[model samples]
Target: MIRRINDIVAKHIQGNLITYFFVILFFMTGISSGAFMSKALTDFQNKELIVYLKNFFSIVDSKAINNLAILKQSLLNNFQTGIIIWILGVTVIGIPLILLIIGLRGFIIGFTVGFFVKQMGFKGVIFSLVSILPQNILIVPCTVFIGVLGISFSLMLIKNKTRKNTRYSIVNQFFLYSTIIAMIHIIIVVGCLIEAYISPFFIKYISTYM
Candidate 1:
């Protein structure tokens, strides 16, 4: 079963390498830009920001362990994002909007990772691994995949159709695409569990030592 799943995933990724590459590039640009900005900040500004971040971290550390609430919040947020992406994919003018959202998500993630890594160096990387990477490990790839697929489907409407294609064919493809999104939705929920239940504990443990 595991091998089969791997093979299926491999096939999907292999078939969309270009799309994946561009999506990855878009995300990496955000990361790089964020890191550069972090690095370029004045020393005084950096110090002030670090102080704020540490205080924020303390607040998070002191929060009660409420996995259920966390999970619900995570799921709701991800679900909303997924639905918006899907809805945008169905519209003619949605291509740019989809890209903007993807870029924004990437920017936020990049800024977060950059902020920590710059503040604590290697320790920050460890902190990010524990606190940030768990959910994003699932989310980032799935998000890119969905974005690529959504763009591909949306473009079908604008493409000059050959004789073999019909509206019904596109409709079928949309349904198939939706089914894939549903599977991704389930994965997001699992990611939410990890983000809620596991990441916090590890992050707290890391913080105590840091």
Candidate 2:
């Protein structure tokens, strides 16, 4: 099973190497920018953030996290993002926007980890591992996948612009695109469940040490 999956992935990557490269590069660039932004925080801002982190820890230690609220927010955010990317895939002008969205997602994650490590050092790393990494393991890949799909679809539309009798082909491609997006969202739903139900426990456990 693992071998088959690997073969499939290898084939996909081989076929879409340029798209994957651009998508991954853009995401990495965003991460680098976010980390730099974290470093550029003023002393006052750093202090304020430290205080906020402390309060967050306190909440986790007290087990005060509202799980349902978290789940609802996660689902809403994930689904909204998924829908946006899916829609963008159907429009030629949305390629840049899709890439930008992917980059922004990376930036948020990079800024968060960069801040944690900068302030708390090793303890901060542990805190980030428990609180942030779990859900993002799923989310990061899904975001990139959707971004690639969006860009690819937009490019397809542009490529077929001069061709005749392509309406049926476009419709077929769109259906396939939507189907794949639906599958990606199912994975996202699982990621959200992990974020809300499982990560909180890890956060609560680690908060005591921090």
lDDT scores of the candidates, listed in order: 0.81, 0.90
Q: What is the lDDT of residue 114 in candidate 2?
A: 95
What is candidate 1's local distance difference test score?
0.81
Please list the residue runs of candidate 1 whose C-alpha ends up more than 4 Å from where it truly belongs after superposition: 1-8, 41-48, 61-63, 160-165
TM-score of each: 0.85, 0.95
Candidate 2 runs further than 4 Å off: 1-8
* Model 2 Cα lDDT, one tens digit per residue, 39-148: 99999999999999898888778767898999999999989988998999899899889889888887888899999999989988998898899998998899898888
All predictions: root-mean-square deviation over Cα? 2.6, 1.5
In TM-score terms, candidate 1 sits at 0.85
